[model samples]
Target chain A: MPDKTAPDAARRSQRSRQAICEAALSLVGETGYDKLTIEGIAARAGVGKQTIYRWWPSKGAVLLDAFTETMEAGEGTLPDTGDLATDLKAVLRATVDEFNDPAFQAPYRALYVAMVNDSEVSAGFTSKVMEPGTQAYVDRIRAAQDAGEVSEDIDPRLAAELILGPFAQRWLLRSQPLTHEFADSLVDMALTGLRPRNPRA
Target chain B: MPDKTAPDAARRSQRSRQAICEAALSLVGETGYDKLTIEGIAARAGVGKQTIYRWWPSKGAVLLDAFTETMEAGEGTLPDTGDLATDLKAVLRATVDEFNDPAFQAPYRALYVAMVNDSEVSAGFTSKVMEPGTQAYVDRIRAAQDAGEVSEDIDPRLAAELILGPFAQRWLLRSQPLTHEFADSLVDMALTGLRPRNPRA
Candidate 1:
C-alpha cells in the first residue's frame, strides 16, 4: 500500500519549489538581476534564505530555472513530425511566439544580461538552456540525413547552428522583429541548403 | 587673423570629450553597466553632472561613444578588397582581435548587456554600432554580386546577416572562443553553403 505521508511530503516539496521559482522570476522582473537578492526572494516566497540556498547555488541559477520553465511551458521541445521542414518551421514559429511574450521578455533579458556579466553564468546558462535545443536540432538534421533528405557531407551540429544562429542574433540584438514570416523564411533558407542537392552551378 | 581664444576653446572641448569618454569606459569596466551612472562618470572625469547631461542623453550614450572610439582606434574602417573571401576574412579577423582585447571586452560587454535589457537602448545600440559594420558588409556583398562572383539572387543584407550571425551568436553567449580561425571558417561556411553548390546532380 502507498504511504499517505509520502504523498503529503511530495506535495509540500513541489509547492516550495514552485513558490521559489515564482519569487525569483518576479524579483528579477521587478528589479534587474544585478539588484535581486536571495533574501529578497526568500522573503517574497515566504521561505527562509537557507531554503533557497539549499535548492540553488545562486540567484542566477534560480532565474535560469524560472526562465527554462517558462520556455518549456510554451515551446521548448522541438516537434518531430517525420518531415524536417514541417517540424523545423513549427518549432521556429513557436519560438517566435515565445520571444514575443511580455512575461518572458524581462527575465529573458535579465538572464542574458547575467550571462554577459558573469562567465560562470554564461557557461551554466549555455549548458542548461541552449544545449538541449541545439542537440534536438542536430538530432533532427541527422535523421533527415539518414533518410537521404539532407546532404550527407553536412555536419548536423553546424547546420543546426546555421539555422538557429541568425534568429538568435536578431533576437538578442533586437535587430528586427521575430515574426512567423521571418521564421518561415529562415526555414526556407535552411532547407534549401539542406535539400538533397544544389544546382547553382 | 582669427582670435587665439577660438583655438584654445576648441582644444578644451576636445579634451573634455576625451576625458569623459575615458571615464565612462573605465567606470563601466570596473562596475558593470547597470551600476554605472552619469554622476559617476562626471565625477571621474572632473566635470559637472550637468555637463554630461548637456551632451548625452544617458549613460548608454556615453558608453556607445566610448565603444565606437575603441573600434575606430583599432580598425578605423572595414576592408574593401575586391575579393569577397579575402575582404571578409580580413574584416572578421580584425573584429576577432578587437573582441579579444581586454580593454575592449568589458565596455563592449557592458553595452551589450544594456542593449539586451532595454528596448530603446537596443534600437540605439544597433543603429549606432552595428548598422555601420553591417552596411559595409552589404556593400561588399553587393560588389561581389555585381562582379559576377556571387549569385545576384542573394539578398546582400541577408547574406551579411548570415556571415556575421554565427560570430555574434557565439560572442554574445560566450559559447566558444572567438578566434581568427573560427572567424575564417564562419566566413567560408556562409559564402559557400554547407551543401556543395556544384554537387553532381
Candidate 2:
C-alpha cells in the first residue's frame, strides 16, 4: 500500500503544478511569447518566481507542460480498439476538436510562434510535446502492421508523419478550419491511395 | 515604342524597391521580426519610411516580398517533364536547397512565426505566398495526371498538399534537417505507397 502522507503531498504538488501551468499558459496567451516572462507567470499564479524556476527551466518549458496538461484532460491518448481506421479517426477527431477550442487556440498559437522563432523553445517543444504525441500514432501504426491491417513494409515514423502532416500543415498555416470532416477526409485519402482503389472508386 | 523617360523612371523605381527589400531582409535577419520596424528599414536602406509605406502595408508584407523574390530567383516554375518522379524530385530538390540556404532561413523563420501569432498576417501570407507556391505544385500534378503519369482521378489539391506537407512539417517544426536525399526519399515514399506491392502471408 502507498504511504498516506505521500498521497497528500502528491496532491498538494499536483495542485501547485496545475496552478503554475495555468498561469504560464494564460500569461503567454494574453501577451505574446516575446513579452511573456517567468516573473509575470509567478505574479499571476500568486507564487514566488523562484518556485516557477524550480519547477521549470524556462517559460517555454512551462508553456509546453501547460499545453500537455490541458491536452491530457481532453482524452489525450490515441484510442486502440483493434481497428486501425476507427482508432485513428477517433483520436484525430478529438485533436481537431481540441484545435478548434478557443481556450486551446491561444496557447497553441503562442507555443507555435515560439517554436518557430526560438531554437531552444523548439527543441523543448519537439521533445516534450510533439515527440510523445507522434510516438503514440507510430505505436498505433506499428500495431496495425503487426495485425496485418496495414502494410508491414511501411516505416512507422514516416507513416505517422504522412498521417498527421496535412492536418498539422493546415492548423499551423491557418490555411483552413480544422474540422472533423476534414480529418476524416485526410485519413481516407492517406489510407487509400490517391488513385481510386476500385473498392471505393 | 516605350517612352525613354518612362523607362528610366521605371528602372529607378525598381532599384529603390530592390534596396528596400534587401534592407528589410537583412534587418529582420539581424534583429528579428518582432524588433524590426519601418523606421529601421528606411534608415538602413537610405530611404524614407513613407517610401516603404507607399509600396507595402506592413513589415510582414516587406518580408513576404523578400521571401518570394528570393524563391523566384531559381527555377520559378514547378517542373512538368511529363514524368511525375522526375518532375517532383527536381522541384523538391530545388526547394530543399532554398530551405537550407542561410540567407533565406532567418526572414522565412520570422515570417512563419509572425503568421502563426497573427491572423491577418497568416491570411496575407497564405494569399500572397503559399497559395501561388502551392498552385505551382498543383499545376505540375495536374500535368502529370493529364499525361497519364499519375492517376487521373487523384485530387490535385490534396495530392499537392500531401507532397508538400512532410517538407513543411520538417522545416517549420525543425524536427529534422531538410536535405536533397531526404527530399528524394519523400518523393519516393509518397509516390509509391508505403505498402509492398506484393505481401507474403
Candidate 3:
C-alpha cells in the first residue's frame, strides 16, 4: 500500500509542476512578461496560488525553468557521440528546431527581453541559463581534445561560442532563416578553418 | 568673389550638419529614444527645425546617420591591410573601442533596441548598418583569399561572420568588458582553429 500510494503522489507532484510551467510559459506569451502574475498561472494551471509561491519566487524564475524544461523535453540533451562534428551538428539542429517553433519561441523571447531590460536578469542570465546550457558543448569539446579529435590549443569555452556565435547572430540579430546547411557550414568552417592558403598550392 | 561666397555657404552647411548629428547623438543618450523629438534636437543644435526636416525623414533616420558618422570619425573604416590577420585585428580593435565609449554606446544601443522592436527598422538595420559594416570584413577576406593569405574554399561571407560574431555576442548579449586581448584571441582561434590534434603530434 505504501509503495503504490507513494508513487501516485510523486506522479501527481510532477504533473502539477508541468502544468505550472506550461501555464507560466503560455501566459507570458499571450499577455507579455510584465503582465504575468502568480494568480494567473495558478488559475490556468488549476493549482492554488500558494503552489506557485512555494515553487518560484518571481515570474522570471518560473519562465526560465520552463524554458529549460522545454529545451530538455524536446531534445533530451546536446549529443555526445565522441565525434565533435556529429555532436555539434545535432545540437545545432535541435536549437534551430526550437527557435522555429512558435510555442517555444514566445516564452524564449519573453525571457530574453527581460534579460536585456533588467540588470539583475542580465547578470544571472549568462550563468543561470546560458552557461549551464553551453556546458554540454564545452564538455563534449573537452572530451574530443582528450581523444585528439580537436586541437588542444582551442579553449573549450571560447570554441563553444565560436560554434554558436554565427547561429545566434542569424537567429536573433539578422533574423535570417537557419537551415541544416548553414549549421553544417558553420561547423566545417570553425573546425577546419580557412587555413591560410598554401603559397605553392 | 563668387568662389569665396560659394566656399562660405558650403562651410556653413557642413557646420550645421555637424551640430545636428552631435545634438541628436547626445539627446538620444540623455532623454532616451521614444522621448526624443526633432524640435528638441533643433533647439539643442541651435538650428531651425526645418534644417533637420530637410536632411532626415524621421528621428530614426537622424539617429542612424549620427551613429555611422561617429564610426567614421574615429576608425575611418574597417582596416584592409595587405594581410588578413593584420586587417582583422585592426577592425576588431576599433569596433571594441567604439562600443566601449559611452557616447557612441548609447545611441548604438537604441538602434539595436529599435531593430528588435520595429519591423521597418529591422529591415533597414540589417541592410544599412550591419551589411555595410560586415562588408568591410568580407571585402578584406576576399582580397586576402586572392593574395593566398586566406584559403579559397572558405566563403568570404561566412568568414566575415566568424570574425564579427564573437564581438557582436559579447557586445550585445554579454555586455562584458571589451578588450584587445579578447579580440586577439578570437582572431587567433577563428583563423587557426582548434583543429583535431595530429595523431602523431
Please, what is the whole-model Cα lDDT of each candidate in the order they appear? 0.79, 0.80, 0.77
For every candidate, the chain B TM-score is 0.85, 0.82, 0.75
User: What is the per-residue lDDT of model 1 for residues A122-142, given as tens digits with 9 covering 90 to 100?
Assistant: 888898888887888888888
lDDT of 2 by residue, A1-201 (tens): 767998898888888888999898888778877678989998998888998888887777788778877755434357779887788888899889988887788898888877887788789889878888888888888888898777766778877888788888888887877888777766765666554333233
**Backbone clashes in model 2, listed as residue pairs:** none
Cα error, candidate 2, residue B144 (Å): 2.3
The DockQ score of candidate 2 comes to 0.46
Give one digit per residue, the lDDT tens place, for model 1 in B18-117: 9999999999889877679989999999999998888888787788877777665333245667777888898899889988887888998998877776
Please provide, for model 3 over B1-201, each residue's C-alpha lDDT reduced to its tens digit, 9 standing for 90 to 100: 356988898999999999999998899889765557899999999999999999887777787777777654333246665767777787788778878888777787667655554446667778768887887778778887888877878998888888788778777666457899788888988888777524465
lDDT for A114 (candidate 2): 70
Candidate 3 per-residue lDDT over residues A60-175, each given as its tens digit = 67877777776543332466677888888877887888777878767866676555544456566777677777777788888888988888777988888888778877876644
In the predicted model 1, the residue pairs found to clash are none
| Candidate 2: segments with Cα more than 4 A from true spot | A1-20, A30-43, A46-62, A73-77, A195-201, B1-17, B37-39, B47-58, B73-76, B199-201
Would you estimate the TM-scores of all the predictions? 0.83, 0.82, 0.74
User: Whose DockQ is higher: candidate 1's or candidate 2's?
Assistant: 2
lDDT score, candidate 3, position A154: 77
Off by over 4 Å in 3: A1-77, A197-201, B1-77, B196-201
Residue B49 error, candidate 2, Å: 5.3
The candidate maximizing lDDT is 2
